[model samples]
Target: MKLGTLVKPLLITGLIIAGPAMAAPSAQQVLAASPVDDIVERYPAMMSEGIREGLKRSPQLPPMVADTIGYVVSNSFRAADIEQQIVKNLERDLSGKQLEAVEGWYKTPVARKISAVEIAASDPAAWQQMQAKAAELGKKYKGTDRARMFERFDRAARATESAVDTTIAVQLGLATAMAAFSPDSANYDELKRKIENQRNAIRGVVEQQVYDSYLHTYEKISMQEMGLYIDFLESGPGSAFSKTVTQSIQQAITDPIESIGNQMARFLAPQK
Candidate 1:
């Protein structure tokens, strides 16, 4: 899941034991202990909301076509499916030590506190609040040490990078949804190139948005607490977990997107 969710971004579950010893924690166990599960559960709605807004700002399509795109996207991006993918990837990609480290870290008081704030920030409602208080946040933390710390946290979390990846995914989904309508013009490779070209511009907007989100999300969190969280994220295990989740989400999101055009085409086809 992306934090600060689709407008922003998103855990773990279960264990087996034998005799007196706990079995090596499965990916499911790690996930149950992590924030990914809760945060990811909110993704379908966040993504739908984000894309709906994006579509509104885009060149106008007929209401029926727009609705079709929304429906296709909504169905294609399922939270359960994404969570399952993350769990599977975690089991396959992360070593036993890495998994144990992640699970342990997430169960920490500091990690829990940070996770709670992050989960809260993933709500679409939170995005609304962030916008409403944007000015207040900017005035209060614009140049302070806390603001700088938030910047460090953002980098540590790769929040801007995740947001950028999400933006590109959404754009690619849009192009895919419209491809059937203009296959000749909607060359996927060409569209991908165009999206790549806008990377720097996208980064500028996303970086500020991510920073603002950090300010808003961590408003109650102390600078010291933020510093500790940043340090963990920069640590080996924490970095591994962050990358794992990021890659998992990217794959889950992009995998479905590839075939969405065909789905949209079928959905928009005339009833026989």
Candidate 2:
């Protein structure tokens, strides 16, 4: 699948979008707050990076070709459009308290540290050290506990589910785009029907890739730290924040994924 083309219409949803006005702060004020702005600034770059990585995995595609296509499509992806969608959602659903909670937690030292690690999780330099540490730590815990810890870490980082879902969405987009753009002589419905048969297989493959990436990303983060992060995600404010962002993102992508998945064989990203 051409990932760049797939994510071209991805409307990024997040926790720090514009929310209601209350005693805590106005929607505009929340937008101006720290960490909120920080995250907002990062999404465009992240979106571009994510698409680039996805394109790099296309079977037999030349690096330059993939890079060029990814770059062009990502460049055309308007951050403003995404923000507007987020704003619309936030305005309708999030309460002032929820907004403040997101802001407050992100302001915390622990949250800052976690976010920094996450932001750098894809970096080569950081991965070298993190992976080495993860190897050491993996041996420290054995059996059931280690397995349990792995699940905790993966969920906290949203590694497995998000990746799998995103890939599913992208692949569906590819199938849809292919059908939509095909010539009059082409059988779009026939192509869609063929894709439908492969959807489950693509999902299964994507799930495996997600698990591998999760294991790698969490390699440096200690089990104890993972526990704490898990706690934060399950906490009142933390849970609210995580759920709000996750739900919004899920909502934004779910339609496209279902639309495409219902028609095309999923475009499976090459496992890293």
lDDT score at residue 147, model 2, on the 0-100 scale: 60
Error of 1 at 216 (Å): 0.8
- Cα deviation at 10, candidate 1, in Å, is 46
Error of 2 at 143 (Å): 3.3
What lDDT does model 1 reach? 0.79
Q: Per-residue lDDT for 41-113 in model 1, tens only?
A: 9888877777777766656467656765676677778898998988888888888888888888888898899
Clashing pairs in 2: 134-219, 195-264, 195-265
Show where candidate 2 strays beyond 4 Å. Answer: 1-22, 25-65, 122-146, 153-159, 176-222, 250-272
Query: How many steric overlaps does candidate 2 have?
Result: 3
Q: What's the lDDT for all of these models?
A: 0.79, 0.54
TM-score of each: 0.84, 0.59
